[model samples]
Target: MGSYIGKTPTELEMAGNEDEEDALGFKLTVLRDAMIHLRVQFLHFQSFYEKEGLENIGNDLKAMKIILMVVQNKIEELKSIIPEYLEIKNIGMVKQKIEDFDLVVTEIVLEMKEFERDNFLMEKVEKLINKLNPFDVPNLETLDQELSPNEMMKTIMSKSAKKQQDKMNKETIQNDVT
Candidate 1:
């Protein structure tokens, strides 16, 4: 993964000049990215274990599922706080929302840390935990800064297309060899 270069929500909050909404938006975006990354990592690890015929990964997979659900729920909660129309319903609630968001994120981090410590899939889990760490939010922020939402969507679609093309090319090569 490329190094991320941008301000974290904590840094933005500490700076005290950034708009509260923007800071919260940045945080939500980071959390969304983290959730996506975590889900992808979990799926990768699960598939690896299954392919290796590792039967002991069931418990770990369950734990990962729970974590993903929690993250998805939190992301939904954060999204609901900011209205779709961009009109601030309760300006006073922004600070409270930030604090609440931070608390949930801290809880999730602790859970991930404990899971990482106890799980057999240590290396992969550790990577996921590190990515989800609050201090590492800047890594995601860099990507956000580099791409607008539409551009990011397009990039993702293009990458998916490229991967599919590569898979077809590999299949063709294998068939030729056969």
Candidate 2:
């Protein structure tokens, strides 16, 4: 079992800008946590599949389903950030979406790959990811920047728009039953 938790994530490129560095640190922090979460999830599923036989690993499959749903919601939230992605133009919504997607994707993609046989889906995801420009996503450092009043207000809209906090809480458990 290889570990996904590698050296601490750092924006080695941002050594030039202190402000950028700070924001990058926050982003990387979020990425790190998400990575760890996904790693644990994958490990759990792998074990479950092995023990129960992949054909009967319903519990493990359900867990993946849950993660996918949450991650999809998160992607929707982050998509709000880049106008290039979708119809929503609200900066807050976009930031929230980005954060949400970041949270889920960092954790699940590597693990999910074990189950996926499709190359097209991976291509689309890669495209969307490449389109992202980090500046559009907000962080505490971004809010701290001094700016014109109008600029501040436009930015204010994004202050509260992340999407992960909107996930559905499923109390019902999935059990194999006829």
Candidate 3:
């Protein structure tokens, strides 16, 4: 055979190993960067949630203030009514004013109930945000050491299957009850 001036088989094998390691390192870097981006997005969502909740509260407060003024005006009108001069017309006017006051009060009560429901929903969203906090994610080193991509995929698939099974079970139970 002609004299080879190139790397030997051992050197070539080592070079292949180095390339593999470099590729793995690059992939790890990319993963780290992606995680950082995800964290930033989570933070943005949290800020938006808080801002939106505050604005909703402010609007609700303004609505309440307006309702309060309406109720106050109705009260003043009732106070001005002279019971000593009770006539058919005055009595009818008083009844009309009372009905209007009742309607306003009913509307305020309904709005309060709606506000309470919205608060409950916001609380649920807050809990979800807490659960999805990116800072709670396992460190990259620990994650890499503990689970390979295949293992992670298996875990996710198993969880999904369990959830689907649970949903089917619930449906069956409901059907039997019905």
Candidate 4:
């Protein structure tokens, strides 16, 4: 495994000016780290509960852990998409595609947040959490093909622009010849 000496990949990507937003980012990182530590503690607690024959509670904890893992994986997947997106020179051409991607990702993040905050589902999840079983939701291995910059260029770019540019070039060449 490659060892990073300083910032993690996300931190490296997120480096910014030391401004008000930067302060907020620092605070967010602190909160995030605290939440992660609490999650680890919960995992240990769940293990203890399982050993004590409190299978239902253990299962609930396992289910929660699985949800956390899925969210984290989704976050990483989205992060990986950013550089590919920024590398595109013809960003204006793929404006609609970019908007679509943003919309989908925002909805996904909102759904997950709502899932976490859902008080109505707490009772149901407690009862059915045991049935959820095995702490691995499927990874998003197959993201939308159009989410790829190369794929978007190939499939979604407006051919009209190119055709227009070609026409202009042809007219220019003919004018020069005359």
Q: Pick the candidate with the highest TM-score.
A: 1
- Backbone-clash count (model 1): 0
Model 4, 1-178: lDDT tens digits are: 2334677777655453223334433433443443354355445644655467444454555555565555344444434443444433443333333333333334333433555454223322232233222221111222211345775564464657645754786487457546
- Which scores higher on lDDT, 1 or 4? 1
Model 4 is weakest, by summed lDDT over 10 consecutive residues, at: 136-145
Per-residue C-alpha lDDT of model 1 across residues 15-86, encoded as one tens digit per residue: 553355466656566665756666566666557666765556666566666656666565566656545414
My TM-score estimates for the predictions, one after another, are 0.34, 0.33, 0.31, 0.25
Candidate 4 segments whose C-alpha is farther than 4 A from its true place: 1-17, 55-178
Q: What ranges in model 3 sit over 4 Å off?
A: 1-5, 53-178
What lDDT would each prediction earn against the true structure?
0.52, 0.46, 0.44, 0.42
Q: Which is the winner by TM-score between candidate 1 and candidate 2?
A: 1
Q: Score candidate 3 by TM-score against the native.
A: 0.31
Could you give candidate 3's per-residue lDDT for residues 1-178 as a string of tens digits? 3443597998776676555544433443443344344334435544655678545455444544454444445444443542432422223333333343344344334544565566334333333233333232233243335455764554445445755864786487457546
Clashing pairs in 1: none
Model 3 lDDT-worst window of ten: 84-93
Write candidate 2's Cα lDDT for 34-132 as tens digits. 434444555576676658765777677677657555545545533442443232234344355365456545534553554555322333333334333
lDDT of 1 at 136: 32
